[model samples]
Target: MKKILLSFFLLTFFQNVVAQTNLYENPNFDELAKTHKIIAIVPFKTQVQLRPKQMKDMSAEQLNRVEKSEGESIQTAMYSWFLKRKKRGDLQNLEIQDPRTTTAMLKKQTIDYNNIMDFTPQELAKILEVDAVISGEFETNKPMSEGASVALGVLFGFFGSTNSATINMSVHNATDGILLWNYNKKVSGSIGSNTEDLINVLMRKSSRRLAYTKNSKDKD
Candidate 1:
């Protein structure tokens, strides 16, 4: 019985790892990032996929609001991660624009959650007066900020419930509008998963390959 249970656990863990893996880095990332002293992190485009029962009480507008809120939550989380790294001297002379400033600038330009995707990354960078822009998309079945209860399957049933989230993060250069790096991953959230924890896990996995990391630049 013990062996059978351990095997099942290992199999489930392996599946989770395989499901949450993807990364890309432009060949010329070093060159493109050379002049990028500052970068702005825009609100991530977010989508919440709720089951029928979950959506029964929510209107379309309410759903949209939830998505917008989630997007901003992710944006703030990402900024916090960068700020922490910068304070730790893990970043390579990089300046992360505050999300409040970024949002204010976008609003001044008549841009909002509904239409922010209409503009190109380069355009956003120019408007925000930054050398590069960090943007991404997040999709989940539940609100991350609220730490909703979710269940994975029997595999997780043994432990507890879990939520699933798919995240895509990318960096774009302002000069030529070229993608410098991209990361996509699917994560299984344990109970009490929130934006900050999600961002911490996501960033920790990608920090080693991030072009702006001090260690990455040192390799050049």
Candidate 2:
């Protein structure tokens, strides 16, 4: 009976993991880059599947409390790393809006955190007046590795290795009001895997890509 229950539980867990959608990412980033200069890093918007270790710390009753506790801090840290990258690269005429300020502004409109896009920072920029908007969701899913390459010690406690959370990024230009770029990245932990390395790496990558190109200025 115990084995049956365990199998049932694991099956239910995998079912939900399979249901996680790949189609959620919008391919049209270029179109989103119109009319804003503030790239606002908001909270993790995904309900990511958990590795065994995370599940150990939280009972079903404590599930909601545990995930919410980490989302805000992680988002802030990731945004900070992004700012550092921009400064390092000497990207001029670029402005990053404070994550906290954006969050507060959204709250004023009675918009829930998940509905951030509907408010569309570009429109807000015209009100507050900014050049561009950058925003994305960082979701962490702890995926375990398969087979005997794994250690027995973890099986006694955990299931296997994890893929960590992939960071999904989107850039929007406030002037034209269109999305510029979007992609999923298995990051090192500016936000997920409980480390800082990934965030810095992501920031650097984004900074280079987001740099105001000479060609773009030529058009202006």
Q: lDDT of model 1 at residue 135?
A: 96
Task: Give the per-residue lDDT digits (tens) of candidate 2, residues 57-163.
Answer: 55664444334434554566666665654566543445666877867776777665546557675675554345655456665554211221132224345533334
Worst 10 residues of 2 by lDDT: 143-152
* Candidate maximizing lDDT: 1
**CA shift of 57, model 2, Å:** 8.5
Candidate 1 TM-score, C-alpha based: 0.82
Quality of model 2 by C-alpha lDDT: 0.49
* Candidate 1, lDDT over the whole model: 0.78
Model 1 residue 81 CA deviation in Å: 0.4
Model 1 bad stretches (over 4 Å) = 1-19, 146-161, 214-220
What TM-score against the true fold does each predicted structure earn? 0.82, 0.56
